[model samples]
Target: MRTYLAARAACIVFLFSGSAAAAVSEEEFAQLRAEMLRLAERVGVLEEENRELRQVAEATVSEVQLARTEAQEAGRTVEEWAPGTTFSGDFRYRYEEIDVESRDIRSRHRLRARFGAVARLSNDVEIGLRLAAGSESPVSGNTTLGSGGTSKDLYLDQAYAKWRPFNGAYVTAGKMKNNFYRPGGAGLAWDSDYTPEGLAFGWSGEQLFINAAAIGLESDSRRDNHTFYYGLQGGARLPVGDTVSITAGAAYFDVPVQGESSFFGDADDFFGNSFNCTDADNCAYLLDYEELELFAELTYSGFAMPLNFYADYIRNLDADTYDTGWLAGARLGKASAAGSWQVGYQYEDVEADSVLALLRDSNVGGGGSDIQGHKLFGSYAVARDWTVGFTVFVDNDAGENRTGSGTDYDRVVFDTIFKY
Candidate 1:
């Protein structure tokens, strides 16, 4: 544009200086100069408008790119939501044999399968559900194989919701997992598969922990018919040194026995607890359970294999006799990964009324109280998520008083388990 303006100015100057000036008037030259100035101003306005349009186009392109990026990010957020929901399960097959003195030996092939799902609804809330292949037994999930290949049944094992109101504290409701910690993972006070229905509270810190629960044993609209179990436990972990630590805790549990028959057992059943016979066919519990428990565990990892020693003691304050029970055990190594193995031994003496009969270890003493036993167990991880194990229980009925009333009981179990 500058070059065009300069050429126009030169042409006009040449025209005026040559013979054309003789015929042209001064008025014509003045009009021509004014027209050239207006034309230059118009060109400058057009250039400014063009620059503004170019900037607008660049900004529109940038906005479109940003919108596209945001859409992709929204798609990824939707994909990430599914990961917050997870599924897990395990399967176990076992061959079990039990022998009782003066009785025929019993053998069975049993299998247990459990599938569970957990959904993290938010940062502070979660929901869980599980299904198990077995009968509606709180202490066991196993189904014996028999009945000419009849199809097994599935039962609702767990349905619960958990909420974390703050750091290191949580509340659980519904038919939830047992919230109390079993020292040494022992089933002296509570069974491994027991899912109690009610509300539970728990809190844990670096070295201290507490658990409490209100378990619903039975619900009846009739007065004094409802039964509930209440439990509270507090513990602390203390470090002896860098390679050794000790954990100790105490717990109290109250189980109400209001009627002759409860949800767990029939009127004729005592399960080694003291009972009074109302008639030839009816019996009632003698006392309510007020159990106090003490537990301790010591772990040492200074050697090639870790060693763990644990003890559990319980006393029913409501009973005068057969009220004390205790167990001591030691375990060497851990079978957590492939090619690893573990071996453990434990001895336990549980007199009548020491703990609740239906809630204690079902695998010992024919699933009742008044038992003294030695348990030897070992496990080997054959592959990832797969393990083989065995347990042998040499137990006797402590309630038997006659000379060898022939109540010696022995049980052996071999299991193959797979987890996913």
Candidate 2:
């Protein structure tokens, strides 16, 4: 019985040992599978992180390029806004030592200084101002309001507002110099010394051009008075070819002169005598007068030598009879090959009548008012911005009454100008 019991115990021990070994193998296999799954999950997380980083890098690069492009566009905008802003001006000083061989005045020395400024306000607008210092006013005779001494005056040489509302039309308003006379090489009138407050309109296209203006005339003394005069002017320029052009224009003015009044104390003896009149001795009185002027100009600039000729007829519209006066003038000028030197000749003639007679006799009158004149002028460029000029002017009295005391007068002038 003891031997059978020992054998059974040994069999149970063997069975239990085998079962424990099997359990141990299963646990090891399960641990290995779990570790492999954990490694795969980690690899997937790393790959996703890499993809996100790449997207962020690409987005950052795109933003940087956009910023660079915007900076370039802003710089271009600024460059266009201030294109070609420039400054320019000129200074002219002239000395005229006059030795009048006539009996009116023996000798005189005159000095003139001029300064001007031109500014480009925008692509289509510009402003300018000119100041002058001299012994005489810009009036033809160089007359002064007060004493004959050096004086400084500010002239609105070009104080006008200009605008190009359309591609081919421009309008301007303010005090503007008159365009009645062409730009001549000589003569004070050609200098645009007289500027009237007015409005001007101009239009130009490929083959057509027109300019019209209406001006207000004011007295030299009472500038602010509401009393005023009006003038109408218009012109057209036609091109015949690449080198030839023709222009024509007309102007009309209505001037009103103020009347004078006086008070006569009461009671002269009754005129038992009455005034009588007959057709042969008829006399009439009027309180007002009007002046009218007509003008034309022809220019040939395409010729081997350029030339300009102009004429005008003036009449007293309110006079008792039909009396008319006229003016005729011509100019010739040439430029050197290098455009450094310019020479010119000018001739002007004036005819006399009743109105001209009164004007010539006025205190502010220069002999040229009713006289013929000729001018010879030359200018040389000393530097890019400097020029020296000389002019000789001669006048002859060709009036009905020999109104200018002398038959001839002459003057010579020298000038230098610098530009900035």
How high is the CA lDDT of each candidate model?
A: 0.85, 0.50
Task: Tell me how far the alpha carbon of residue 330 in candidate 2 is from the true structure, in angstroms, after superposition.
Answer: 4.1
Report the C-alpha lDDT of model 2 over 330-410, residue by residue, as the tens digit.
655444333466666655554332132321211111332344566677787777677888877665343433333535566
Q: For residue 169, give model 1's deviation from the true position in Å.
A: 0.5
Q: Using alpha carbons, what is the TM-score of model 1?
A: 0.78
Off by over 4 Å in 1: 1-81, 222-225, 258-260, 280-282, 401-406
What TM-score would each prediction reach against the true structure? Answer: 0.78, 0.55
Evaluated with TM-score, which candidate comes out highest? 1
Clash count of each predicted structure = 0, 0
Off by over 4 Å in 2: 1-86, 99-112, 117-126, 134-158, 179-191, 204-226, 241-243, 258-305, 310-313, 319-330, 335-340, 351-368, 382-385, 398-407
- lDDT tens digits, residues 169-280, model 1? 9999988899998877888888898989999999999999999999987756473437878999999999997899999999999997835454554656666777777786
